[model samples]
Target: MDHIRPLPAYLVQRYHGWRATSFAENRSWYRRLADEGQRPRAMVISCCDSRVHVTSIFGAEQGEFFIHRNIANLVPPYEPDGDHHGTSAAVEFAVTSLKVAHLIVLGHSRCGGVQGCYHMCSGHAPELDEKTSFVGRWMDILRPGFARLPEGDDATRQQALEFEAVKVSLENLMTFPFIAERVESGDLSLHGLWNDIAEGGLMALDPRDGSFHPV
Candidate 1:
């Protein structure tokens, strides 16, 4: 608490602007959202990248999506060992409680986490290889994706791994019993997408070919 400080001037000013305009214009909508709670139709698992604005990309209004962001947008296999699992908990709440009809994994190009995993696997990032490195342990989830990186130039391989990250997460999501059950019953669907940050291009995964095509 002692270390906590007030919001930065820029962010505070932005908040004031938004509150005066957006919040004021949608006062009833905001009140209804608070009163009825969120009932989003989709759960988006995306990277914790400032550039990857999910709501803005989808033109989604408040309460339209239940989003969970993590490094590289990785989702580890389901392991109920009583440990704290933030991503898994969010998925559980979204699926079992919220009953989101769609679960989307959104990976992006130039992902720092994915790049770190790539370098770590290639033995170029020693710091990330340290036994006590939380990033290293977390990135272990992407090893399978790394292994699938196609033989190519640096840019191609990086983009390939980005797509693989989305694929790996979607695969891991199915490992959750509840999610698997829902998919089996046609109650939910899974999707994978890769975003090219610079060009604002989106590619969707074709499960049949295990390849990404422009969306």
Candidate 2:
């Protein structure tokens, strides 16, 4: 621990404040959650964007939802190769181990990751086109989604691609055999959600029409 630096004064002060307020108010609940283990009914795969507040939108308490955050909230296709796959690993644990009834992919408007993919694919971002860029490689998963987007102006295209990203993640989630099995047996349900960050509006993908409707 000698190499570790001390926490910043502001963050330390904020942590102590939370520990005294929220933690104190929910002391018994927190202790019960720790003792019983988390049995979250839903597993939410969301973007790492600070503006996308999944817990606040759903009013989810601690231990109520298992959240996995990453760039653009994407779920790549299932690949069984012996390699490190963080997203797939999380999905396996959520489905097989946790037995979460609902798996939600939450995408938000103006996502940097999605925009990066958009620019990269459109030959607008040369930096991201480099093979050495980890973000570029990761955003490649969204290439197919971008290709499917209808032609439009920059703003319209960006919004369409955002929606496509959610659809793509939903499709990829089904590529996992375990997930597919549970979904087929009606034990698991998949959902796609897009949040309008500035407007605080949410859109839910309708399974029947394959369209997103404001919710």
lDDT of 2 by residue, 19-118 (tens): 9999999999999998999999999999999999899999989998989999999999999999999999999998999999999999999999999999
Worst-scoring 10-residue span by lDDT in model 2: 145-154
Quote the RMSD, in angstroms, for model 1. 0.9
- Candidate 1 clash pair list: none
TM-score, predicted candidate 1 vs. hidden true structure: 0.98
The superposed Cα distance between candidate 1 and the true structure at residue 68, in angstroms, equals 0.5
| CA lDDT scores, all candidates in order | 0.94, 0.94
Residue 94's lDDT within candidate 1 is 97
**By TM-score, who's the top model here?**
1
For residue 101, model 2's alpha carbon misses the true position, in angstroms, by: 0.3
